[model samples]
Every structure is written in C-alpha cells, then in structure tokens.
Target: MSIPKRVAERITNRIKQFQSILDAQRARDVSEADTVTLVKDLLSEVFGYDKYAELTSEHSIRGTYCDLAVKIESKLALLIEVKAIGTELRDQHIKQAIDYAANEGCEWVVLTNAVEWRMYHVLFRKPIDKQELAQLNLLTIDTKQDECMERLYLLTREGFVKSALAEYRDRKEATSRFMLAAILLHSGPVQTALRREVRRVSEMLVDPAEIDKILRDEVIKRECIEGEQADAAARRVQRSAEKSIRRASEECEGSEANPNPSESPPVQDAH
Candidate 1:
C-alpha cells in the first residue's frame, strides 16, 4: 500500500530519531517501565498518536493490566505488551499481548521492547490464535527503504484509520503457504490440472488418490496439511469458491431472464 508522502516523511524522521534513543537504552539495559516510556514516545512521535490521550499505559483487561493500549477517539485500536530493552521478544510475550486483545475484544496487538516491534492480528477461535503480521527492528531498519517505511506506516495512526494493517494481514494470509497448500490439495480445477499434467508427462493414467496421497505425504509440509490452521484455510477457500459460483449463477439467471436488457443512456452535462 502507498502511504502519503507527508506521513512517510514523518515516519522516516521519527524512526531515525528513535534509533539513537533505542540504541542508548539497549546499552543501559533499560527496565520495562523505561521501555514503555520509549514505546509511548514512539507511538506519539512516529505513529502520530496523542501520548496522553491515545496511548494508555495501564490498560485493565480481566483484572490484569496490559502495558499499553492505543485508543483513538475512545476506540481501542491496539493492545501492546512491552519488555525491557535488553529482553528478547518471545512467543510467551506475544501470547500475553494476544491475551489482552482477546479479553478486550481487540483484533490487533503489538509486542515490542522499544527496539524490535512486532505486530499481531488476533483470531478469536475455539482457542485464541494470533498471526504475526510484521516485525521491524528500529536499529536495523533502513529508513530510506520503501518497504521499511510501509511496514512502519501500518502501525501509524493514518494506517489504522484507513484499515491498512488489516488489509496487509489479509493480503499476507491470502497468498500464505497454508492457503496455497489447501488450494493445491483440495481445489477441483487444480486436481484436474495436476492429473492431466502427470498423464501428459508419463503417457500413463495417474489415479487421483495417488496424487492426493503424494501431496499429503511428501509434497506439502505436514503443518500446512494438518492442524487447525490448515483446516481454516481450506474452509476459507471453499467459501470463496462457493461465493464465486453463486455470483456466476445469479449473473446467468439475469441474462436468461433479460437477454436484451436496456442500458441507461448517458447523461448530458448542462454546462
């Protein structure tokens, strides 16, 4: 997604400014509280959030407090869990961040140590799940790179208002390995094409079951073919196919009913 030049400039400038502060803080092994302070400052200066009004430090959720929350116009945008500058961000930290988001019915969460920032999209399913959308290290990020700027933009106030982050997550999931594996394995057209290609190459009949077995057993990763995530991806593909079929059916019926439907005449401008 293309970010506005003005906003991109601010993000570039702020990231450059914060890189030095984060580097010094990391050298001192700053405390979590100090890290939160830096994060809040980043949110305000870089992300265009009001430090006092939009960034809340002690956000309560289910009798526990998350380190920081980004709330704009009284709407909660993100729940963040901060770690000390010296601490490495881990799965446990993401779990805690997603837990806060899940409890508060928030869809987004962030885990950061004022240097490395990780953004997650929380999925509220049978058990809460999260997908890491973007991870950027201020120390290593190149402010001049368009990709780095775009990644940082998704966490900014303008990006949140424009739903860029959610769009980015959707785009990531749409072409994800799990989604591709599910489509390759279960899609009818894909299966037919595979069988046809095999027959063409070998000049022999290949059973569908054999192809399926090979895919399930050897070709695709076990994680991509097995487990809850795989199941969800398959369901999503099925739903998309179903919707396309329905739309085509409706269009066919319309054409059959009104084969020569009249088109609207163009309106003339009254200049």
Candidate 2:
C-alpha cells in the first residue's frame, strides 16, 4: 500500500528521532513503567494516536490491564504490551497480550520494549493462537529504507484507518509456505498439472497418487505439510475450491434454465 507523502515523511522523522531516545533509554535501563510511558509517547508522536484520548492504560480484561490499548473513535484498535527497555521480548509477553485481545474479541496486539516492536494477529481458537505479522527494531533498521518505513507505517494511525495491517495479515497467510505446501499437496488441479508435466518431461506416465507421494515424501518439507498451520491452510484451500465449484455449478444451471430470450418460438404463427 502506498502511504501518503505526509505520513511517510512523519514516519521517517519519528524513526530517526526515536532511535536517539531508544538509545538513551537502553543505556539508562529504564523500568517497565518508564518503557510504557515511552511507548505511549511513541504511539502519539510516531503512530499518530492521541495520547489522552486514543491511547489508554486502563483497558482491563479478566482483572488484568494491558500496558496500552489504542482506541480510535472509542473502538479498540489494538492492544500493546510493553517490556523494559533492557528486557528481551518473549513468548510470555505475547501470551499476556493475546489473552487481553481474546477476552475483548480483538484481533490485533503489539509487543514492544520501546525499541523493538512486534505486531501479532490473535486467533481466538480452542486454544488462542497468534501470528506475528511484523517485527522491527528502531535502533537496528535503516530509517530511510522503504521496506522498513512501510513496516512501521502499518502501525500508524493511517494504517489502522485503512486496515492495512489486516490486509498485510491476509497477504502473509495466502502466500505462506504452509499454505503453498498445502495447495501443492491437496489441490486436485495442482496434482493433475504436476502429473501432466511429469509425463511430458520424462516420456512416462505417472499416476497422480505417485506424484503426491513423491512430492510429500521427497520434494516438500515435512514440517510444512504436517502441522496445525498446515492443516489450517489446507482447510482454507479446500473451502476456496468448494466455493468455486459451487459458483460454477450455479452459473451452469442458470444458463440452462434461462434460454435466449431473443429467440422467438413459432413467431411465424402470428403472421
């Protein structure tokens, strides 16, 4: 997505300015409370949030509070969990954030330590899950790089308003290795195409079953084809294929039922 020129410029300037603040904070080894304050400032100054209105420290879920919650127009946009500047972000931090999001039925959360920011998409499943959409460190990234800038832009106010992060999440899921692997392994059309190519190249007929076995056993990695993520991808592909088939069938039935209205049957009888 192309960010507006003004927003892009603001991101560039803030990234540079925050790099200095992050450096000083890390040197001082600030407390978690201090880090939360820095994060609120970052949200306001860098991410285009109103400090007093949009950013909240009192958003509680199940008797616990998220460090910061971004609410635009009184709707919760995202939950942020902060760690101390000197502390390393870990899975535990993400779990806490995800718990808050799950209870509130929110889909997005962020974990930051005033320097490194990790954005996650929470899946409220039987057991809650999360997908890390983007991770960036202000001190390490080149602030002027477009890719880096774009990543930061996904967390900005404009990005939220545009649903850029959701779009990014969908794009990531659609093109993920597990999704691709699932398509290759389970998609019937893909299997047929693979079989045809094998016969054309080797001058020998290959059964679709044989091709599937070879791809699953040798060509594709086991991890990509055998995991909870892989299963989810496979289910998504199956659902998509089923929908396509249903639409085609419905169109065919409609065409058969509705013959050409322009054709007149026995119009000559009137003459």
Candidate 3:
C-alpha cells in the first residue's frame, strides 16, 4: 500500500477502534487531561514522533504544564492544549498556546478537546511581535465523520501545513500593501483631490488615443497634452488671484489718499 493509503487506513482503523470507548465515556465521568493524553499518545504513535513528544504536568520557565510539546531537530515545533469533550474552546485556550509558542519560539500551536482539533500558525514579525495567523479545524469526531476526518488528515499532512504557512505570510504582505496604499491615497482632501484629478486626466488621455490607433502611437502625445492643459489651468488661476489682489491693494491706497467724507472717523471717548 502507498504511504497515503496506509496513513488513511491507519487513521480510519484508529478512529473505529476508539469509537466505542469514546461513546462509552460520553456519559461516564472522565477527566479532560486523560482524554488529552489518549489523543497525544495516538498522534505520537501514528506520526512517529514518540521520541520528541512530551506531556507536561508541572510549571516550567516556558509555561505552566503545556498539555504536549513536540521538538524537531532541537527546535520546538509544536505545542498542544487539551480540553474536555464538552469544554468550549475559547480565546483563552488559544492565547495560552500562543504564549507557549512565543516562549518556546515554536511555529505551530494546536488546541484540542480530543474530539476536535484546531491548528494555528505562529506568525512572528520580530522577536517580540508574535501572533497566530490562520487556524484550521482538524476533526469533528462528534459531528461529521468521513468529511471531518479527511480534513483532519489533510491538516496533519506535511504539504498542507507548508502551504497554509506560505499563504499566511502572503496574506500578511498583501494586507500591508493595501493599508499603505490607503494611507497614501487618502492622506488629506487636497491630496485625495490631486490623485483623483491625475487619475481622471490619465484615463481620459490614454483611452481615446489607444482606441483610435492600432499601436497607440499618439498615447504619449495625448498624455503630454493633458498635462500641459492642467499646468495652464493652474497658471491661469494663479494669474487671476494675483490680479485680484493687486486691484484690491490699489483701491486701498486710493481710499487712504482720498478718504470718504460720508464715512466719519469716530472721536475718542473718555473712559
């Protein structure tokens, strides 16, 4: 059997073998930590990470008893947090795993309740700036059966994790570019207006010339014309404003020399 097929079969058999145990424990009282241990053991056995996987039950410098930790080549690669079957996984759980990842400089975090697993990528922009990037829902052992398991296996696959991490990095870069463009394009009203005017003129100038010519030989010439027109308009406005100001100043000088008799100067009153 191929590796993929064997992996699938192994997972299927594992799920089937554990199904009855899970069903029996549904009504019985059982600790979440125990369930987490079962899952950790299963994963370690199946994935051949037994040597690197460790279950923490005591506080360490990195964190207080992380459910499980996996090391690869002397580097912490994965952190896991386990909850009970009915326990609601919340931001606090994710935050705790994130904190562990930060301390250990790990790249992956997993939050699970034995039945369902969520995988997160630790995105680090710098030594201090670390965050969870994308989360994948791995398994829904209580709900969907085949579909959820397939997705879970896909998440666990080596290629899928690499692709997801790459996509997360790309998405961050694209978001940064969008924010930068927004800042530059909408800095102020004057800047906004200027960009709009420039874009409008560019579009108008380029469209007709390209539409008329096969090779658009006149496109550059048309753009030059549009630019000249804009410059001329600006100069015209400047000239008109200067003329108005000069006229106002001359009128003020004439009024000072020949004061209007009808407009009386008030006499100073004793305070």
Candidate 4:
C-alpha cells in the first residue's frame, strides 16, 4: 500500500486499540515530559527513526534544550516539543521551537501532545528573527484519526521536506529576479548604480516595454490566426452544403421528367 493509505490504516487501527487508554490517560492527567517520551517512541517505532534522541535540559545560547531532536546525515532535520493532552498549544510553544531551530539550524519543528501534533517550518531572517513559516495540525490522534495521520505522514516524508525547501529557494530566486528586473526598468540614481554594478559582472539589459509589446502581439496574432481558421472551415462547410442542394434539385427535376409511377421524390441531402 502507498504511504498515505498505510498511514490511514495505522491511524484507524491505533485509534480503535487505544481510544479507551487515551481517554483514561486524559482523565488521569499525564505530564508533558511523559507524553514526550511516548511521542519519541512512536516516532522511532512507527516512523522508523532509530537514531532519534531527547536533548539534554541544558540551556544553550539560543534557549533551553528541545524535547526531541533527530539527526540525519549529520544534519538536524527534526525538532519536537511535547505538551500535556489538555494543554493548549500557544505562541510560547512556537517560540521554543523557533529557538531550537535557530540553535540547531533545522528545517522542521513539531509541537504536540499524544493527541495533537503541530508541524512548522522554521523561517530565518537576516538579523535572526526566528519564526515559523507555516503550521499544520497533523493529528488529534484520537478524534480525527485518518486525516490527521495521513497529513502527519506527508510532513514526515522526504519529498514533502524537499518541496518546502524548494519553495524557500524559489522565493529567494523570485526576489532576485524581481530586483534585477526593477533595476533594468528604472532610470533613477539607485537604478543607475545597480545597472553599473550588474553590468560589471554581466552584459544583459532589461526592456519592460519591449516585453509587454511582445506578449501583447503574440496574443493578438494567435487570436487572429484562430479566427481565420474558423472562418475558412465555415466557408468550406457552406460550399459543401450548396453543392449537395444543387445535386438534389437536379436529381428531383430528372425524376419528375421521367415520372416513375411507383417512386416518390428523392429527399435532399443536408450536408
């Protein structure tokens, strides 16, 4: 089965098996740290990350140690924090995750209890403003089982991580493209300085009006060509129909002159 389908089944089965236990745990009230341990085990067994480890509670330059950190290929890829089942995830949780990400330079962060999982992208600014780019609630792991787990698994997949990274890279690329285009179009002093700097390294100049004209001309030409083709097709059909009608009229006249007693007039062909 595909990963998504498999995750769906696993979530369903887990919910059925653990619903009562989960409810009892909620009733009994477990600590966040204990929940973190459970989550770490789940990640190791279910998600197949054997090298996962809980960070020591030592305070670092960025912040306190994160709940769980996973290192893959000598790079920290995942960071997570655990909260109690009843505790609401707040901005503080996001702040802590961001600190861990800043210190570890990880791309992803997860904050959750056993029931609710929230994943985020660690967005980095020039002067080091640590904030999350996006946050997705992966699972309640109790109520909305299938949907939650499927989404959670999607977050865990390598392709999904790569896609997020590609998006960041594309954002940078788009910004660069826009800046270059702007410098090429503008005639101000700042634009002049930018142009000289750009020309020192390369030999390309941008013409905004030329680009606009090219696009407009292409669209108009395409429409005209399509319209001409349609007109030609209509004319061909009209001629064919006229030819058919003339032939039918001649045939009818011939029949009338011959006067076949047993036969009726032939029907005209509607071409």
Instruction: Give one digit per residue, the lDDT tens place, for model 4 in 1-271.
Output: 1345555555456555555655666677888877766666556444545533423323243545667766655456677777886687786776767766777677677777766666666656654453333344323344254434445454443424445434643454334433333323332444457556656676766454554355346523334323433344335445655787899999999988888777778999999
Score candidate 1 by TM-score against the native: 0.89
What local distance difference test score does each model get?
Answer: 0.89, 0.89, 0.55, 0.55
TM-score preference between candidates 3 and 4, better one: 3
Candidate 3: which stretches are off by over 4 Å?
A: 1-3, 45-48, 51-59, 125-150, 154-271
Between 1 and 3, whose lDDT is larger? Answer: 1
TM-score of 3: 0.49
Per-residue error (Å), model 4, residue 90: 0.6
lDDT of each residue in 1-271, candidate 1, tens digit only: 9899999889888788878888899999989999889889999999899998999877788888889989989999998888999998887878877877888899998899988999999999968998889999989989788888889998999999999998999899889889999999878788899999999999999889999999999999899977888998999888888988999999999999888779766799999
TM-score for each model? 0.89, 0.94, 0.49, 0.48
Residue range 1-271, candidate 2, lDDT tens digits: 7889999888778878888889999999999999999999888888898999999999888888788999999999899989999999897888878988988999999999989999999987879899899999988977577888889889999999999999999988889999999999878798788888889999999777788889899999999988799999999989988999999999999888877867776645654
N/CA/C clash count, model 4? 0
Once fitted onto the true fold, the runs of candidate 2 whose alpha carbons sit more than 4 angstroms away are 264-271
Per-residue lDDT tens digits of candidate 3, residues 1-271?
Answer: 0136666666666666666665555456468867766666556544435443333434254436777666544445577787876676776777777777777777677777765666676655554333444343323352135544444453343424345445544565445433333323323443445556656887543432333352225422434224433344345445655787899999999989878858778889989
Q: Assess the local accuracy of residue 174 in candidate 2 as a C-alpha lDDT between 0 and 100.
A: 89
Q: Return the number of clashes found in candidate 2.
A: 0
